[model samples]
Target: MAMKAIDPQYTADTKYALEVRNVDIYYSAFRAVKNCSFGMERNKITALIGPSGCGKSTVLRSLNRMNDLIAGARTEGEVLYRGQNLYDPDIDAVQVRRSIGMVFQKANPFPKSIYDNIAYGPRVNGWKGSKAEMDELVERALRGAVLWDEVKDDLKKSGLAISGGQQQRLCIARALAVEPEVILMDEPCSALDPISTLKIEELMFELRQRYSIVIVTHNMQQAARASDNTVFFLMDKEDRAGQIVEYGPTEQIFQSPKDERTEQYISGRFG
Candidate 1:
């Protein structure tokens, strides 16, 4: 299939809140991502679509430097956040992760209480507010995730005690409490039921006014329904590496994608 994102001169706007430029990733000697690039508009949701192992999740993890946790995983090229390249030697990956938070496919919360889960980031970063202030922030975060009413009475309950969907929302609340400028989610709704997925989708809409969101999903309908833009990924010739094939407005990409691979993937013919 024709790869539409290959034009090397195609530079996305820095006015965008986030930018991925010719990014390549590797695990030890094996390359897993090859020259993927895209730009994300401020406070908008951008969906990454591809088959499993097509580097969608890898790209998402690279954004906040999660891949760095692995001993042999390394990335080539730079991820620019608000004009600054995140991979620069001078940049602190920790700060980068804080500015851009992440959510995973499975809902994973600490064994700690719900209150502690929401307060974890802020506390670690030194949030020294009065009890009333912390309480308000926690409530706001829970409400933002649309979980306050259900768990408000049980703030002391372990976050793991909640249902899968509720736990996912709680994870979202924890990410929000840090007041990040960008949030990355990897297949967040894959394990959720229809009702719960709708809530998360609705939450994405509500969040766009304040936070830039990037999501990786195999769900074409969810990507088309929830995101303003989409990036379609594909495997390299050897099938050992993945790369972006196309990126554009969601309507354009889904309805009239410039790349044949994108069309095939979105139309359920392939992924």
Candidate 2:
């Protein structure tokens, strides 16, 4: 039997770094995801896991209003940041994005030199500081991404000149440079080698101390190993809209899921 939609719990008693409440995402009249709600704990990593086209990425993008860039994309209900609705007409999407930065599935670095790439966000956001201060900030951002030691001597090199893994880390560094409160990653490790993936996972653990994280991933083991909380999404043939079936602490979601569909998917019986 298929599972019904999870109730939209406000969870007002516990403070959340970010909250998606009773949201329905759509492209034109076609709904992609239906009535999703969850709260992200501060300084914790939350992973959204589901099959392809099940709207895990769609939900992730909605956190910062990234979906607004798409043609005909719209959302119903609220996506709250620090208890404020992001979709409120008074809110600026650019400001929202600045507060909650994103790293894509693929490594996308600018055509500029590595140093400039790291400094770009601060410059665009108007950092009122001296050259020395900007330089220190760049170095700090790179070091936070665990890439400073490797690229410090070659600051002038194009960000694209690096290997794939290094490029991905550079993107992470670039996102960090903005000093955002929450970082949304869309399958960040999907394109990396095993070693690179491990390094990224480890970096995530360290990053959670300073920033909240929400990641969309198809890798079950990655979600189980890297996330503090996990959300499971599924779509049935009768209704194409992706629905979140279960969500909870990572260990319980993996060890003993509340929904049979969640159990089946996590157990490798089906995706």
Candidate 3:
């Protein structure tokens, strides 16, 4: 079957890449995230930071309908992309995922060769390119992730044979292979070493020039260091649902939070 195109309302004039409105997410009867509203600017990196189990990841997954994969998981309200609601009935979840790619907390490269790892997404999406074109595409994605130089000499090697950092980069290159407009990362550096984390942070800056990025991170320092904007979430004690405490430019969020809860969280006083 032919894939559905995004609604024609997608004009170049839209200011934000994504506008999340009054979004609430639930797993079965439990509300995980409540009333999230924020605009992710074009070609910028936005960080979602909060303590664990506060629904930061839940909200991140909803942006691309990843939550739908979980049984009994659902989302209410809208996630707008180019003026069209992604949750609309006619919207294609597969296409939504293609347009908005994801990189999880741990690097998970397919057990295939390095070249095949990068080529997999495009191939799955029905790439009709010739062998030479596929090679070029693989090279482009690997270079984009800054992994080309290290792995170029061994494209046939198994992706798992690489170092953990290299495996993460390979996973990133795999995501880049499909040329997504928005990239959602969930604690992408949590398992990496400091050097690997630094490399990923640098890659995020480079990628921000071409793609909109939203990352869910537990590392406050990483959020402050790498993101253009920050959204802080906290669990509502009574309801046990996560709620946004503040959303603003990274500098402002780190230096001077507006909400006392945000201030307390950032200052290490409480979760």
Candidate 4:
């Protein structure tokens, strides 16, 4: 099927930290997401919320070319990071991921020590520093994710040995270790308990002071509470391809959405 979007002409101004411009994602001939577009502001959180299989995660992964890791998966249109199209052939996907880091729905820590998990990215990215500098970096990252106090004495412990919530925070700290300009989270709290979820949300609030964040979440209340902007997606029944249906401030989206579909979904009328 030909690709299309509910808001096909969407654009972002210079103030945006990153922007998806009429992007379509596909695996082979199967289009997973239609021309979805939205902007993420610097030092702010933008949440992508929708029902299952609406391509919320697909779109989030596209920001850093994570989709490229899938066989035959490709993206169409522009994904601008610092004014450069990330899909361009000259762009390095590795560097893209390094700059725009990601945390998955599940906590996937490396089978290494907590300190090593945090050091891995920087090492791969050619970070050359003394032991003290590397140690400081690790401490800063753990503290940034709010995991230092709990795991400070356990830096030598295996990342997998930590609690699920702590493991997720460790994954987050791993992302921050490289000092990414933007963080893409695919339901970072979905696997955690309520308390853990709240901690992640609060950490997001604090992290936004230094990094731009884009989160794909199914939780409507979480989106309303944690994000400055929200984009609602819906699948086109005919094509089974997802598209952005509404995009605006979180308050407007929750209180007075311009689209009735957004209202119905958020109000628990239908997914």
Candidate 5:
């Protein structure tokens, strides 16, 4: 399906799930990404693609303030969600992260039982429900990630005992358990086999119906196939900071990119 054109400017009436305006990320003195701007539409999947050292992951991490965990990592400029600046002094980073959950490049499920893994987030966030209600919530989250049928009977098994793909899905389920409005995936399928990667792509489609998704991926084909919109980033040779080269509907970005650099990169001529 064709995606609507995104206006870089945000207004009170705009329908963007998240609007990143002039965002610059730095690790201490080195600016890693500069002046990045884009809007991720509600219920659509947006992919961030670039070669190595282009700050794709850095941009993704900033969406939920995950960068805050790294020493000396800081972000300047505004990331607006629901018309509020997420970087405001009054904003709570923990709540921001809860509302915009993340899945890492590698699946790092806690070393706990599958049930506990899915239940952990809600519990920490003050779940006041009976056992049956918690069970229902867990089931719903697992079903949302397309992993319910595969592991329904093994809820007591160690999360680490599952296959790599199942572990990834379990991690996704854990994120869903928190009922986030947006999901950020940083190469969630990078370590999976082809079939597992396809499963992850399919799960992404299902999840997009309810939550906005932003993914950072190096796989061009995956970006072309799975995303409604695409943002391409490249390093600025002058200062070695990453910046957006192009962003638009996936079809146009892949078929007729306006920038020659975009075309060259997409066609594998150069990074």
Candidate 6:
């Protein structure tokens, strides 16, 4: 059977595929994310674009609770997944991560074979299936990631054996194997060359057909081209905090943003 996603309608007004409601994140006594609230539509690509250290990646990691690993990193408010509060004490952070996947910049593939990298998730989750089934899942994931043709004959090769671009795609396939509902990517193309960046941008469009993708990127042009919605974050007056400066349909934000900071950032006048 095919993998079915959270319904499109349910992904929309039904609390969004992922909703960050009045979120406040702090590192020890210092606040990072202010009372931020946003809803991500289902199967859509939402780009979180901002300058360096503007908390774009922070928000992305918050979606999957990756920030919790930091000793003093604290989060307040709710990260709702399909209407359920992800921060609820009853929720399993591991389970939350499985359902909502993430890919980081630099294409940090595992030190294992390509096959093992993709199989790792399901295996740890007790897939306990036949070899054929595992093989099928691997191929399906690679194809979904648009990487099968480049890697099919060399599944036994170490993941690090591939080119930088291909390694990123392999990482993407690894995320896909679990069939997660959301894919949180942090500056995914920052480490790639222009050609590789273009390829990843194209991949982002294709991936959105099945998964809700939230990406944090410093490249404004990439955001304009790949995302359905754009969220622009900029540092505050103290330069110690960041907030969402502007957010709306990609067209609006790029064409005529409501804030002066957005225009400055988009036009490359200021950070």
Question: Which one is best on TM-score?
Answer: 3
The residue ranges of model 2 lying beyond 4 angstroms of the native Cα positions read 1-13
What TM-score, computed on C-alpha atoms, does each candidate reach? 0.93, 0.94, 0.97, 0.94, 0.95, 0.94
In terms of lDDT, model 2 sits at 0.91
lDDT of 6 by residue, 27-101 (tens): 999888787888888889999998887888999999999998999999899998876788877677787888899
Note the Cα lDDT for every prediction shown.
0.90, 0.91, 0.93, 0.92, 0.94, 0.88
Which residue pairs clash in candidate 2?
none
Report the CA-based lDDT of candidate 3 relative to the real structure: 0.93
Model 1: what TM-score? 0.93
Candidate closest to the true structure, highest lDDT: 5
Give the runs in model 5 whose Cα sits over 4 Å from its true position: 1-12
- lDDT of candidate 1 over 1-271, digit per residue (tens): 3322222243456558789999999999988999988998898999998988888898999999999999999999989876678887667677888889999999999999999999999999888999999999999999999999999999999999989999999999999999988999999999999999999999999999999999998788999999999988888877579988889999999999998888888889975
**Backbone atom clashes (below 3 Å) for every candidate:** 0, 0, 0, 0, 0, 0
The RMSD of every model to the true structure, in order and in angstroms, is 6.6, 6.5, 1.6, 5.7, 5.9, 4.0
Per-residue lDDT for 1-271 in model 2, tens only? 3432222353356668899999999999999999899988889999999888889999999999999999999999999875578898777788888889999999999999999999999999988899999899999999999999999999999999998899999999999999998999999999999999999999999999999999999899999999999999987567699989999999999999999999999999987
Q: Write the per-residue lDDT of candidate 4 for residues 151-223, one digit (tens) a residue.
A: 9999999999999999999999999999988999999999899999999999999999999999999889999
RMSD to the native, candidate 5?
Answer: 5.9
Write candidate 5's Cα lDDT for 1-271 as tens digits: 3332222354567768998999999999999999999999999999999899999999999999999999999999999987888898777788788889999999999999999999999999999999999999999999999999999999999999999999999999999999998999999999999999999999999999999999999899999999999999999999999999999999999999999999999999997
The window of 10 residues in a row where model 4 has the poorest summed lDDT is 1-10
Off by over 4 Å in 3: 1-4
Q: Order of candidates by lDDT, top first? A: 5, 3, 4, 2, 1, 6
